[model samples]
Target: ASATERVHLGPTVTNPLTRHPAVAASGIASINRLSGGRAYFGIGSGDSAILNLGLRPAKLADLHEYMQAMRTLLAGESVDYKGRSIHVKWSNNQIPLVMSAEGPRTLAMAGGIADAVIVHSGLTKDVLADTIARIREGERAAGRPEGSAKVWAFAKCNISDNHDDAIDEIKMALAASGHHAFRHTLEGKNVPEELQEAVRVLQGEYVTSQHEQLGETRNKALSDELGLTDFLAERFAVAGTPDECLAKVRDIRDAGVDNLLILAISSQTDDLIRRFGEQVIARI
Candidate 1:
């Protein structure tokens, strides 16, 4: 129904360590103009992209500064960066900025700045509620109204009659989600005390090079060996029969997720998308 809904580069890293915030803003503004204002920028603290390069995720303060710089540049204004002035003179798109967050601090920061947030926390009712609460906390801190920032749930998905196969297919993605969400810290993440050690082991053993790979990588193997596949699936995925996936989606909607960012990581990605559109999305 809206032009802005047509395209998004959801959850790309626009951190200073990865890409200069000024350049990223100019790029998005260019794309927005070219696409008739259909483009919005989505960013996050670096994950596999930075880790694979042997770098840490951007510090929260740096991320916050980058978001501020982006806001100014995209609005056709000049901003100072490291004793230099930067501006995107050709464009003034002011496209929406969406941030991806998995942890409490990141969620709060995103709520303060991002126009929307793609939450990588699990879809369980309690977890989703807590994540939203953290975002609201940030909003309140920034003097923004309640529910000012929209929320989108990031979910790994597949549709199949064989439930076991479906689960197996997305284990690697679920593993990636766990690594992304828990690698920084386990505190306040609602991680059970009993499984904390296992989670730490998974975080250490996870292979950044094979992130989200479809095959039986070491990441998937570690998830299985650590007895984490089912737990990760329950938290981060929505894979099963069409009816089952639809029910899960409805629950997510009820939990106040304003949008769904489905990550179809299976080899049959096209088929899964088509089936989800027809069977799950259509019904919902």
Candidate 2:
């Protein structure tokens, strides 16, 4: 132990460091005891972090297997595998399984297995509400009570006095975030072909007609190709003053989202974050 005492699962190919089932459980137990049951475990299927690692994406089934294995190990139960009781483990703390869900399969799995489910950024109210529905479906299948899946959302938000500047920043984030940061779940929600194409080309599979960097010259084409102009402004994120942004949050809440993890963007995040903390979030 470093006295600071930190151990993580081995590095994951897709996301951040991934813990093998046995190793992850042990570390979780260790942290739990050290923190007096205050430790938390979060599982994600490699996002851009995974992509940058030159690895394939993670699957929902894989997450479920990991969660089950962790639960079994931490509960002091030895699972029988390959003619042996494998990885005997135990802990006094209730190790919670939280899933970072995006697509339908992952959403359903989180609803069924995860103690809590977190929705990632580039969010739209319609998409958020639909994802939650899928999660609830998984809960029902598992015979769990209603609202068993605790749903939360994470977003890249930019708030500013100059709405145009804020819009530009949001556009840049959306242009790139589509590929790996967000999943394509808003395809047939009666959205435009161009916006759909933008999301699809980024996340789906479509080559650009021209050569350009994603954030530089190329993003404009990509945004235009995908028709992200209006939709990006409307559906993806909230960027504006406090009063303006709160309406967006209200819309997301009305769509059944439970909690929001806002990534406030600016030259310095403090200004935007403080404003949200003192004004937007404080009031709402």
Candidate 3:
């Protein structure tokens, strides 16, 4: 209660926490003012996070409604709820709306109402291009200005001759397939025949967080548990010397990534981040 009284969070982070839209509006406004316009709200459809809390994730319909209400209130407009338009009391009408999106529908919806979309990594070149196309489509549908919404991809970086350590770092980073990079890096687009069989038996009962594997992680434990070979995991991560690491990221840039968040893979992250930033990022 003491903590709740001192801080006003901008709605629950996911759909299941559909706490009242009016309450969300008031809280976001309060925080936005306090932060002097530095506040940006990010939200996503609840998945594992919701399940962890024993709550069911949100439906698309509900997410869309929530976004619209959030936008209206942040714009300083009192919005009516349901068919009857409800108004929020003491509305500040001055906060930014950003939605966390890694999937198609959510990306489109973010364009429709939110100011930005947080794209999860495992964002392959082809995938990012497609996702961007869909987000633009939503902007067109909503009659919003082009480039009104921004998209950010989750990213990780580690550069060293001993990048094997880096790969090892990313392996443990993901547990239960709860991330973006791990999904594509390990599982890949073409499902393997063996995994396909596993897929058959598993069907909806899928195990492992394929998305949690960083593009540069090597978890021997996870690999062995999943019956994966080093060769299997190799395709997902970028290791070897600094020169090799630089080239890997150039490909990512070529694919058209905009924002890349470098998760700390080393105790010397800032120096390494700067090293990569100055050398690799500067060139590309």
Q: What TM-score goes with each of the models?
A: 0.95, 0.77, 0.67
Error of 3 at 216 (Å): 17
- Considering TM-score, where higher is better, how would the candidates rank from best to worst? 1, 2, 3
Deviation from truth (RMSD, Å), model 1: 2.1
lDDT of 2 at 233: 59
Among these predicted structures, which one has the highest TM-score?
1
Give per-residue lDDT, candidate 2, residue 34: 70
- lDDT of each residue in 39-137, candidate 1, tens digit only: 778888888888999999988888888888888888889999767899887777768888888889999999999889989888999999999999999
Candidate 2, residue 244: the lDDT equals 76
For candidate 1, which ten residues in a row score worst on lDDT? 1-10
Q: What's the lDDT of the predicted structure labeled candidate 3?
A: 0.57
Better of 2 and 3 by lDDT: 2
Ranking by lDDT: 1, 2, 3
TM-score attained by model 1: 0.95
Better of 1 and 3 by TM-score: 1
